[model samples]
Target chain A: MTSTAAHSPFPSGRAVPTPVTGGRGGLLASVVGVAVGSVFFLFPIYWMLVTSVKPPSEWLTSPPVFIPDRLYFQNYTDALFNWGGLKGLVDSGVVAVSATAIGMVLGTFAAYSLARFRIGGTNLSFFILSLLFMPPVAIGIPMFLFWSALGLVDTYIALIVQYLTFTIPFIAWVMKGFFEDLPVDLEESALVNGASRLRAFVDIVLPNVRPALVATALLAFIFNWNEFSIAVLLSRGRVTTLPFILPTMMESHYVLWGDIAAMAAVGALPVVIIAFLLQRYLVRGLSFGAIRSE
Target chain B: MMATRRRPSRWSGGRRFALLTVAPATIILIVLSVFPLLYSLRLSFTDQQLLSLVPPRFVGLANYAQLLQDNLFWSSLGVAAAFALSVVTVQLGVGLALALALYRLPRYQQFIATLLLIPSILSSSVASFQWRSLFDYSSGPLNYFLGLLHLPLLSWTADPRLALPSLLLVDFWQWTPFVTLLLLAGLHALPASVFEAARVDGSSSWQILRYQTLPLLRRVIAITVILRLIGAFKVFDIIYVLTAGGPGSATESLAFYNYVQGFRYFSVGYSAAMSYVSVIIVIVLARVILRYMERPVGRPAADVPVAEAAV
Candidate 1:
């Protein structure tokens, strides 16, 4: 139902003709529109970069310095080393990687079962999909309390487990879609040749779904990395993530724009790059397999 | 080939393996999500305080009763509703327009769409900080730009009147691209044949869009709106960073208010009640959206053209 065959303008081995009606005026208008929109979308990112390099004096200038007069490389180091920024980044990284790895492993096994065996049938898939609709805040407070009672607050395990509530379901659903699209004959033939089901799955199905696995892991990592409310509620100063730290940084007695900008830029850089590099899969992942653009 | 000997054991073994594979995820989800839900529901009925030395006691409907009477709770709900409504409306409008424009410009479609998605992908906290600096009264780039344009520079975050709108602006900047991408995906999924037929019949572009494209896109649009609405309802990080729901709680959303109640004020039971109310609201919205999804698109059968209906 969500296949991109008809929607994708650039289908494999086929070229779609540009519609013939629009004239030069239309082309010019499209060009101008795209240019203006790109600037609007890109300006803040550009500003973050420029502001990160600007001297402290230029941060609050009357006519805001569009470009820094001198490069202040200290901002990056200061933001990273001082201000507890490195700790935040490290915490975020550890939680995200752990959650992604765990979710991927669990999801892959479950998805393979669901796809190949039709275990629990179609209603089960729908049930998993329903979990995606839940607003995180509804369960966030309770989970916070639960973690606190267990003496697990401010621990990586608490965040990773919370992250799994969303990621595992997502990975299961998306990977199920991917598994269904793969040819079943290869695995079946292997089974006929006396390979154990697990062995065949390990040797045959696993390699075929490598790309999907990577995409799912990347998307899950980004979600965990960018998550805030759970991180805020669950972690006190001990395991503060970048998103939680950014707000505290803003609330400091003296606002340092350069440091904030540098930290923000650095914090956002990895995910932004990953999103761009894996744009196609990211789009597919974002849609929850409802729009399989890939 | 020894087919019969291997078949029975293999079949049962496969079933057991499937069960084993799915068990861990199911157990984890239940422990994390379901247990907490039940726990919170129980907590909401008791007057539990994190900092207080008093033992918790079941108060039946007292917390819910208090929640209904609390002006702050009501205001936060109203703020959340208003915020969600406004943000979803603006994002839908602007996102649809941008999607349409990008659809028209086939050459730069991919590049521009990717560029526009940057904000949506960035951490909300990061985006909030970027906008917070932009909305800064004295030295912020926004006011400076307004000054250059010879327009009055308003205090964006500090003024109660402009605070919500300022936050909305930031939200619009961050999430409109998300809507745009979804709509674009929907547009791509549209059957090209219908548009071609409409053009062949000399239907105007506006007419084709209004009749054919929009009708076919009903489900996609509904899904996008529902997702955005839910997201807007849960908004916390941006509000926390940008205004901290400040100017005397003028911009406090339900989630942010609950966070404040539970963490800052240490009113555990009251916050659990608030979270349940938020969940109930989301459930209602989801039900309505699901109903819309189940309904047939466009007008009823009697109003349809016979030729089109035949298909």
Candidate 2:
């Protein structure tokens, strides 16, 4: 159902094409409907922004401050410095980046084998995709026991290793889809000309799917960065990711609404930017390649 | 034997390359995913406690037997089911409406869709916090708006009855856009010629949608539904932040209860049993969906020309 007429015969990384024409009266209603729906969807984000900048006095006003007349940078500074947001974000960054680097390299190769050679065929593909569906707690329990036994809990290595359970499979499955979409003519011809298998793949195949590689990596990074369940089980206080820190803030003597919002905004900003940048592949990535971008 | 031998010899180097490249990821998955699953499965049958000094002893079927009769288990399953069903249903309904609406405005579809990605793109923890302020009893914008309309102020996540619904609201806000995006893509893929033919035959817009558009959209809808179902079942982040399964366990999902058993109470054996159950349920659900999704998209009815059929 993802077909687009104008798609080039040779697969190049691009988004699904726009739809054909619409009926006459439906256009006006669509405008109004989408506009209203946008407000409903966007209001909470606006509220978060408003709360983040509201002064302490305006934080809990009965008539909620829709617009915080006076902007405050104190909340941002306090959350970043006094609270654990900065440290937590840094921890999250290290874990996500390192894990993604390893996962992409490993996954790209596995994906190549799966797509090109059809290794283990459907069963192997199913096994990998199923990992995405497995609830984290199932693995989290056993992982906790294993890591604790190794005395590796709360270390960056422990978190990075655990993250591979998700990232590797995710990248492998998504990238496999992209690889399959690519024609093998170029690689075969390169190999026939006496280029080594690895060379043919690295020199020809990799460049064609560059856009997909980046999109898959970013999506995998987001999953790692947003992880909460495994982090909650594995980390005590030593290795706090941004998501893990928010709950602790809520548990404090008094809930710091402004500070929490500030921290959340800080954590969410990067992914929001990436989400737009990779908008073409967003649906494909989120759906784990089930819905192709034509 | 001869065919297999010939196949390998034909691409001997390629075969070796495939094995070498695939080995690392396959090994990692085995260690991290397969090994842990097997360990957890073993743990489920044994009386193990992380905090205990006593060596673990196997107690086959005890934990599973207890789970069958456990009231808390039953209640939490009920909660999980209710939350999953309602959220999936509502999201699909609202999502279809919005997608159809957006389909009519091709000029602004991409722009609007991009903007709609914001909520889903945010981490669940951050999204939950955003909602936390919105559902606050005293200072929440929702209640404030209620007050302006002369309605009594209502506690959202604090009240026992309202708590789950409140969490549902947040899930709805965050995920409906995703459903819309998928369905809109499906809508776009429908052939324009089919719609034009139906229109020429004097069929109304609703008739064309009912007869032509929907049948072609079944595959996309199925994929979307299963994906959402799997996601709804695994919902933990928002529930953790928003309600913490509070107000006398009104919002305590099976996942949360499992977490409490495994992590907080350290009933390793019992928690592992629950985890196995959850995994089995998800595996079964996903298996069917995956097979359906993986099936080749053959010639859909829309591809058949309309003029020839009328003759």
Candidate achieving the largest TM-score? 2
Name model 2 segments beyond 4 Å from true.
Answer: A1-25, B1-13, B295-311
Clashing pairs in 2: none
- Writing each residue's lDDT as its tens digit, candidate 1 over A1-294 gives 123333456531113222222345645665576577678778888888888998888888887888777799888898888877898889999999999999999988988877666677555554555566666767877887788788999899998888888888889877877776676677778988999888888999899978888888898888889988778778778888888788777666778999999999988988988887887776568766544553
lDDT of each residue in A75-114, candidate 2, tens digit only = 9998989888889989999999999999999999999888
- For residues B58-94, what per-residue lDDT tens digits would candidate 2 score against the true structure? 9999999999999888999999999889988899988
TM-scores, in order shown? 0.89, 0.92
Superposed on the true interface residues, model 2 gives a C-alpha RMSD in angstroms of 5.9
Q: Against the hidden true structure, what lDDT does model 2 obtain?
A: 0.82
For candidate 1 chain A, the 10 contiguous residues with the lowest summed lDDT are A12-21
Q: For every candidate, what share of the true interface contacts is present?
A: 0.42, 0.52
lDDT of 2 at B71: 88
